[model samples]
Target: MKALLGLFILMQIFIATNAQRVCGTEIYTQKLFAANPVIKNAWNNAEVQIASTTKAATGFAARDTAANEIIYIPLVIHIVYNKVIENISDAQIQSQLAALNNDYSYSNIDKINIPAAFASLAADTRIRFCLAQIDPQGKKTSGIVRKYTVKDYFSPEDGMKISAQGGDEAWDSKRYLNIWVCNMASRTLGYSSLPGGLANVDGVVIAYDVFGSGEHVRAPFNKGRTATHEIGHWLGLKHIWGDAICGTDLVEDTPTQQYYNYGSPTFPHVTNCSPNSNGDMFMNFMDFTNDGCMNMFTIGQKQRMRALFAKGNLRNSFLLSFACDSTLAQGSALPAVDTIAVLSNKPLPQNTGLKVYPNPTQAGVNIEYIGTLNNISKTVSIFNVVGNCVYTGKLTKEKAYVNMANLSKGIYIIQIKEGSNRLTAKIIKE
Candidate 1:
């Protein structure tokens, strides 16, 4: 019995050590590029824009002190499972969310383990995430969709993303960060669509066993950093080794290195292309290092991520995604595609100069808009504490009025959406 136990222990170690982090992002993107062809050029343009907009040509895209604020991303997790064990619990989902928040905000307790040489370079991305409070139909939701599939496993480039193929179709990609957790085929742990990929298939996919930070989760990949890493790819962050020998990841603070690093490499793990004693940034979240070994994203990476969310950038549409707030959901069904179409129509969210008045009042309220809202129909919808749309009307000229005398004395969300532009404020009806 003792010999059998020792053999099991050795087997566990062997499996752990032999397992490599296989991210299908590069191959997936290459196939996508081949299919669309034009997407490659458009993606290149987006990269050039990111490079041009980086702050001050600094080694790191230092936080925008003047305008830097926490950006909250709303997520919708599609769990496509073939077996009962593959359907992860809500606790596991929440655990992954917590881990993402910590790592992105640079609040991870493991930061202390980052090498002193690169510790100071880690930046607080000021990015946070939450499950969607509203579904694409504008109804209340837990933000998690569980669908059973007949297939035992899905390939990195398989029909796992399409509902017709037994997988759940993605919700509106513009308003929510859709993440699919399923059993990936082969040794691939996950893959993600880059910024310019097809909208219908835009998302990140992770293998079920490596998703959450929980005891049920397998080791090494179990810390929930797989999402963090794949999301980096979704947000336009390249692998630390740039997917090539001594390649560039487009981030300056990160040292140039030859190929990717596996397992926990020692400090100053110099590569053939190492420029200095401080070698490859094998500990970066973008590297293929074990989840426990990866701890931080350099300031340069934070900048690259931020560049996509800047004004008129690729990811700026997320700013108007009120799906994170439950109270904004519609009482009736509204197809997600229509809402997303409106979201995609705008050039960029412009300052609408919108205002809501008569707070804590006995009578009605006045919503005023003083910007380019003439041709575009700006509709105002009011909702109570619950996610029920109480009243809906159109904004005429520059202002619209809604009678609230019958409304109970309480707070309400006054929301106005015109194309992708949205104006929202809280008002009291007394």
Candidate 2:
């Protein structure tokens, strides 16, 4: 009788402990859900809007045709550290980027060892993630911004601060997508505020451990997939299960699961959805799988991500047709052209001769032009390689002072335009 009582007591303790663990995890996730309600709601609403808008815009009877368009997301990584990891090296950043591109493009599955039963569902996201080579105003950049902060670890709110700092310090939210990488709170790998959200600060925050350079990081989580998952959120995707059993992730194909999974899950694990004869999609990136084990984003999830690139704030800033074309043209530019001309619709009238003095200026550049009084209403636009507009102003006089002291040593373009004539001059800021 004593043995039976002892066994019962131990069993109760085990069950209680498991319940507490589960509850704790839920509490942490709830904090994320509550703090980022804006993004959560926007994602839900965007799905409805996308469904209706795509149907109307494509004039097609099916969802697949509308989703076929390839999506290109330009990324900017902000590395905030306290010298522990003196900002992940560029090579490390590149590695993480490669991982993202492979996963989203469905190329990573080639590395996976899959059983025959679940093989047919394999999908390529048709989405590409690239470091922003050109900024919003058409300026060239490395796309990695590093800052030193005193704080040990950043909270979700602190994450917002870092992103805002990036925006203020040369990061362009309109063209280059911002990603904040820091040592965030304990037990938190990463969290993202989706597009069109209240905290939609145009960035995603990831914990250092899950980022690149796994030297000081732990196993089962160090392969940089944390950034991958957070980026999915940034692109308007939700957890595969939508955080509840009955809740839909809004993807038509992904199976509904009751809980999140950690570590590597064994094959053939059955679930309520019984999606495939094999079982639940615990190995999907949207799920909480170990980095090495998580390799695919489902076809449905891919459609949703592509759909996001089709509308809203992201589309306006990052998906403009001109921006896309420029990106491609610049990417293909070899031997690096000394000067490239970008003309606005309105050009300066004939007889306007624009001159930029000291072609390579150390202190400041002076602009002189001979034109009619209509030039007073014209504008001067300066851009760098990545499409970042460094300066813009209406022409007050034929002469303007362009301070170059604080500017980095690089090639810059200055354009002067009036009614029908446009002139471009290349100036080197040294």
Candidate 3:
């Protein structure tokens, strides 16, 4: 009887330890699962396509072949908080940007000291995350939206509301990536419903405490890597260990592990699927490691991420305007003018003036500025709607002619600059 009781107690300890490590904290699992039912219902209703396990294999392979391309992501940050501490500052948002760019580019990971075994597998994803300089509707936005809500925890449903309201204020999801930062219930540190999941929401939600500023948290861990990890999930990359021992994250190279890890783990911790000489990859970004200890995304993982850029609907929409070979034209090609005509139909800022002459020209288009020149300078450059810079030259006092004969027949922009004063004029190549 004594032996049986001892065995029972030992088994219970093992189960509890395994459970805590697998799902993070108990509170996190309960709250996160509670939200899963809603996502499941949404999926069953055909509102979202929850990717099945079979799809993971094909998705993994497709991403591996197209890893070299660049992905342009438009980011929107929604801050929901009750007070200032809950409300992160703009500088903090910028800091998050700096960290994300570095991590995604593998810049920060390269700085970490790692064994050569893992270093060789490290990849620098060519993707870049930028604040939406121009929104889907062609409105200018700083890309940060703030909301004061009494609610502290954000469920997947709340994620939907925030994305709808916050994104509407910025760019549509069809054009921008939405990221919501708020105080999560103490139950969960972070959770992301995958893109094709039943709870298919179009943004990422991070617990306010884990979002930014080390002041609210501890060092290294204080940085916003939580966003980095969840964003990976949002982009379709699964946890590096796979959700379960029987499950696979779908990357060919990452060894399977029995469960996830929380906090900092020692090196060479062997697992069932990773009993090799190098042991398990617990320090991977997808795992729950201290920020200082975590580094690197495997080449396989990079391929998976890049695949989302290639095929995901929300991701591909942002790439339509970001191609590399596109270029803009300059003003020296503008047709020589006997007289300039200013279009007065459109409203102009006070003291602003614009003129174009030699309406039908053989050589190029000529532009003359009057009034305050709106502080706009004489030098002007041209670009197409796709933001490619083609030509640039000095304005020569108050007049500048952009040579346009070489340019193809299309619409172009004449960007005038002086100090901080910038103005754009549209011209056509005949």
Candidate 4:
């Protein structure tokens, strides 16, 4: 009777601790794999290939070290908010970007806290993200899609990925990273569709309050690591604990962990499966630690992430995605005939708002074409302070980048003309 009671108590401990940091990714993927066994077969085969190819074999071309050029992913953040606070501010959204860049680039200052044992394994993934300047239809966009959702909470089965279900639809997952920030049901901080999952549901879903590092965001999770963790899964990384007891995450440098770690575990937190005195690498982004506790991705994990982008692999399509460079999105949208340019002298519509960012730009400037100016085809002309047209580009409802790297440092005027409507904004190139 005592043994039976002890077993019940142990099971309760497992159940209670498991609820601390809930991520639906593993559960979601397992359901997907069960529904379609072919997917599981394909994933297992791909893992074998990835392991061998990324193993630093002599004479083999490694995906990560190839030229060492950074990979920039274009993102379209879909904000589905039912409440005012759920509709996070742009500053909060921006804070998530800053956190991701710092984490992936190894530029974050908190990295200094990593234990000396695992510090040598830390890696700069060479991956970066940007709000997509050009959208799927070749239109100007702020790369932000905000829609009021009647459904206050979404489940992991992906009601959030379908517009018919009161959630915003995903963009072309092959070309742009679709991030849906909303209120998640079941206390799920976040979840993601893995590389081999259906494209329509491919991407990350972050709960609003835990999505960014901005003020008033939840403690222990406000540092934007939820997005980072889910995005890591989207990029083909498994949890450091491998979602199982004494399991393998498939990365060599990351020591095998008995199970997920929660809160802040003291250094040298040993487990039965630990390979050395170094113990578990709970600081890995793939672990279930709090946002501030998680800090690095190992070199082995970097290899796994970069492998998805190899030629003919699942994410190879991103290599050709020019969504990051809006200059290449020429005439991606059509304007209503009534909104055609009447004349450059036409008065500016009161509803039209023009916003340019990083005004004193060293190179690229993002011009967001929104409000009444959205979708209407317009001519974008850049003139020097002396009024000479030095550069010209096409503009529509979509946001695009105006390359000023080649132009001499000075003040410039950006003019957009559509029918009798004209909007002009001044920007300085530093």
| Regions more than 4 Å wrong, model 1 | 1-18, 55-66, 331-430
- Assess candidate 1 and give its lDDT: 0.77
The digit string of per-residue lDDT tens for model 3 on 1-430 reads 5455345334433554311222122222234446677644543432122232223424532332243566767687766654336556666777788778888888883446666667878777777787655544353445665554445455544442443433113235655667777665433456565554432345666766667645765454566677778778777677776654435777766777766665667777777667486767776778766666677777677766655544443255556743211122222222111111334343322323455655445568767655645223456777765556788877765665677888877766666655433445566666
TM-score of each: 0.72, 0.63, 0.60, 0.73
lDDT of 4 by residue, 1-430 (tens): 5455345334434564433667888778878987989988888887876776567422255544355668889988887766546766667878898899999988878899899999999999999998887878776555776665667698878887897998888899999999998888866888999887788988999988887795757878878899999999998999888766787888888999887788988898998889888899888999988888999999888878887887767788888888888786654322111121112234423333555666677896776643544624777777775456788877754876778899999877666666544445666788
Best prediction by lDDT: 1
Whole-model lDDT, model 3: 0.57
Residue 105 lDDT in candidate 3: 89
Once fitted onto the true fold, the runs of candidate 4 whose alpha carbons sit more than 4 angstroms away are 1-19, 57-65, 331-430
TM-score of 3: 0.60
lDDT of 1 by residue, 69-105 (tens): 7777899998877655676777888999999999999
- In the range 1-430, model 2's lDDT, one tens digit per residue, is 5455345334433454211211112233345557877655765576686665444433444433234566677777776655325345667788788888878777774446554565566677776777766544454445665554445676665443443442223255556567777776545677765566543455667766567635544566667777878888776677776665534677766777755566678876677766556776777778777787777776667666666565453444556533333444443211112111212123432333444667677876776654433335667777675546677788776467667777788877776666433455667777
User: How far does residue 95 in candidate 4 sit from its true spot (Å)?
Assistant: 0.7
Give the candidate order by descending TM-score. Answer: 4, 1, 2, 3
Error of 3 at 308 (Å): 1.6
Weakest 10 consecutive residues, lDDT, candidate 2? 333-342
> Which regions of candidate 2 deviate over 4 angstroms?
1-43, 51-60, 63-68, 84-86, 109-111, 160-170, 213-217, 273-276, 311-316, 321-430
Note each model's CA RMSD in angstroms.
16.1, 15.0, 13.5, 11.8
